[model samples]
Target: MEFRNTLEFAQEMDTKDPLVNYRDEFVFPKVKGKEVIYFTGNSLGLQPKRAKAFVDDIMTDWAELGVEGHFYADKPWWDYHERLIPPLAKVVGAKPGEVTVMNTLSVNLHLLMVSFYTPKSNRFKIICEEKAFPSDQYMLQSQVRFHGFNPEEAIVEVKKRDGEHFWRTKDFLSKINEVGDELALVLIGGVNYYNGQVMDMETITKSAKSVGANVGWDLAHAVGNVELKLHDWNADFAAWCSYKYMNSGPGNASGVFIHEKHLDKKDVPRFEGWWGTKKEERFLMKPHFEPMPNADAWQISNPPVLSMAPYLASLELFEEVGMPALLKKQKSLTSYLEFILNEIDKEVDSSFEIITPKERGCQLSVFLHGQGRALFNYLMEHGVIVDWREPNVIRLAPAPFYCSFEDMYRFGQILREGILHNE
Candidate 1:
């Protein structure tokens, strides 16, 4: 893992990479007729080459079968969501019966919170990380208000110590202890959206359970990026979006995971829909709600197949590549990226600090201290597709499915020129 900051080294690594051919399966965006160095897969992954055909199949089925497509189409719209369970389970480390593809991320979060976040007289406070994704912060605020509790009193934020960008495991565990018997639920993003720190979900889950509190994770940035063991970790529930690392289309379907222990709990409260009813009893149009005995019990509506087609198409690649292989490339490629950027910082005398921890996925959140947003703009204008957080952070992710080591080298080259131009 001795990374060299040279184009020859990067290209040689690329040539030897067993998964390098995966780059061909995606269609990258172009700027001025050349392919851009795409590093935003942590935000929205590039479209898979097969996505179009997947959508076409859905379109053709709709055209030919109309309403009957639910039962007669090649994929059978009635059961299309089930097609994703195997791969999706593998991605999140859950049993197929413990996972379901449905709803958007926020909506699923709300649904799960409804079932798991109930607060009573003594155990009424919820613990979460400071600076969680904006949506999560908003959701927690509203949920607290909906339950007739003051947000200040009911929501406890576990913040990093002064001047630190990431939360240590002890910091979070201490917060869990501080909350004590008042803690009702512990919810957090598995991988932080801004700093790209992969939280220790196992220890968090066990700690929360020990304190008689429910726990869940929003895996939005972690789903296809890091190794997750939601089932073994005993996370009560979890949810994630597909568009980012999963490489589904924009605003695609999201996935949910519920522990098997919760599956047979008929007494659990949830906002149910017909799709969540037992499939056998569904056709009878029973007035009473009879929930499915698995994670599908959380489904509030039938899935949108067109939106899910690209996700299904993308999951095939995950099935083929497997997470272990992808994670190996992720660690190596991102480490190389970190090394190159550090080398560039030294060469240009610029203060580029990587805020993400070594236990990260493919992303490196570079804190550009002096160079500022001008460098981000310059990189974009020159065809390097990376994400810019407000203030001074640039997020670069080398996705294992499509990003190559050479792309990392090209990015370093562009970034070097950008720093020099700014100077």
Candidate 2:
């Protein structure tokens, strides 16, 4: 499809878009009394308009039922988290029995490591990508330290080629083979937060297992943004936050995926609590810990219904539109954005080098060559909401659920004007 940098062309594409109406479902923040072009969905998603009502229902139920709300609420707070399973499962391409909602991303990763990151005297090294998200880096460091090992020796980082923006799959495969018997686990972010590159999880997971290593993914950027098959990929475990593309809220709850093969195993080591036990035996407070038959076995506490409410509300949108439709729009919308960027770069004296590779989802991490923070500040003041990384890179994720083609075109215009103003 030929792309144009005109408002009419953008509007025409929106008119043809099947998911265009979803833009209205979210409440965007205003800058100078106009809705800003939000491009930071990779950092935090806009609030779903329906989220307020979902929270209200929980608030009203608590007011009416008091202590009995756990059993008497319309959705029954005791089991509210279960309602999120089916839709959340569908979004991540896993069976309902293989997924559950729980603590935040880092917390869940720590818990999952208890089951999957077992290291022995000879096999103790973990393989991960170079420059992983800070939380993941800290978590892996602490985990290896707790097991009495130096992080420098226990963690094998797959480095990108010098001067390249993204990692090559062959390098990871070669690293796994080099580490060989010493590799105990392979945990890396599915979609790199810095470069927006989607790792080839299926191939990497296969290679990791062949070397007797457990594989896991931190899907913070990948979960709702790209296609995932945690179950089919045979990933031992994975975790993601809901506040990004999932559109829950700031620092909201997270989702977990545990393979069916790991569920209901009494011998599997885990940090257990009452909520993880079988529901029938939970009230009994029995002496033995009988785990849930599914992924909920890893849960350590009762569900936070208030936090889960907004997530459930967002999943309604997912169920209605489906990931397939979202992915289809995402490809076209992102392609149009790339075209707009190229067009703007040609017209301006400054260079805009998109660092995000072709394997990306909705995000485009562009290096603003010959430009500086003044341009980013101008963009923000002019009602363009985007994320600025250290140095001159800006991450723009035009989420398909709410972001429009018009936003991309308008952003290109604002960006061009900002560059010209700075000169």
Candidate 3:
């Protein structure tokens, strides 16, 4: 598809977009009396307009039903988390029984690691990407130490070669080989948070499996942003937060994936709770824990109804629009954004370089060389809301649900002006 760096072209694309009506479903942020061009959905998505009503209904149920809400409410708090499985499964490309809503992303990762990260004898090392999200780094380090292994000796990091912004697939595979028989687990982000590179999880998982190791993913950025096939990819487990791409409220309930093969393995150790007990016997108050048959076995407690209401509202939108349609618009929006950014750099004699791979979803991480916080500050003051990473990168994600082509053009225009002003 040909792209033009002009407002008219942007408007024309927006006019033809089938998903244009979706913009109306979300509430945009205002800056200085006008709606800003929000490009931070990769970090935190805009709230859906129906979010309030969704939460209000849950509130009303609690008010009228009180403790009885667990059984009699419209959504039945006892099984409210089940309502999310169908659509959420579609989002991550998993079997309905393979998916479940649970605790936060890191907590879910730790719980899954308990079952998948078991270290035996010589094979006790873990392989992960370098400079992972801080929480992941801390989690892996602690997990290794908990097993009585030095983090420096047990954690093998796959790093980018000099002058490279993203890890090459071959290098990642080579690291898996380097770790060899000592590799007990291979855990990586499905889509890297810093450079927005989408890893080929299927190939990596197969490679890791061939070498007799377990594989998993942190899909926090990939869940709703990119197309995934966790079950098909044969990933042993995966976890992701809902707030970023799914547009659930901040710190909302997260989704987890446990391959069907692992679900029925009762001996595959986990930290259990009452909610994980088989439903029929859950209230029996037995001394021993009898786990559920699917991903629900990982649940530590009943889901937070108020926090999950917004997710249900967003999932309804996902069901209506679907990932196929959403990803289609995302391709065009991201391509147009890339084209506009390239033209802006040429027009302004700027030094910004996009580090994100072409295979990425909505995000483009731009390395703003020579220009620093001043350029970022200028754009924010002028109503372009993008995220700034420390040092020199600005991350922009034009979410397909609400971001329009015109917003992309507006961002390019503002960026050009900001660059020149800072210069």
Regarding lDDT, does 1 or 2 come out ahead?
Answer: 2
The TM-score values for the models, in the order shown, are 0.99, 0.99, 0.99
Q: Mind giving the per-residue lDDT tens digits that candidate 2 earns over 1-423?
A: 888899999999999999999999999999999999999999899999999999999999999999799999999998899999999999898999999999999999999999999999899999999999999999999999999999999999999999999999999999999999999999999999998999999999999999999999999999899999989999999999999999999999999999998888899999999999998888898988999999999988999999999999999999999999999999999999999999999998577899999999999999999888998999999999999998999999999999999989999999999999999
lDDT of 1 by residue, 198-287 (tens): 998999899999999999999999999999999999999999999999999898898999999999667999999999999888889889
Best candidate (score: lDDT): 2
The residue ranges of model 2 lying beyond 4 angstroms of the native Cα positions read none
Global lDDT of model 1: 0.92
**lDDT: worst 10-residue window of model 2:** 344-353
What candidate 3 gets wrong by more than 4 Å, as runs, is none
Span of ten consecutive residues with least summed lDDT in model 1 = 1-10
Q: Rank the candidates by lDDT, best first.
A: 2, 3, 1
Error of 1 at 113 (Å): 0.6
What's model 3's TM-score? Answer: 0.99
Report, for every candidate in turn, its global Cα lDDT versus the true structure: 0.92, 0.94, 0.93
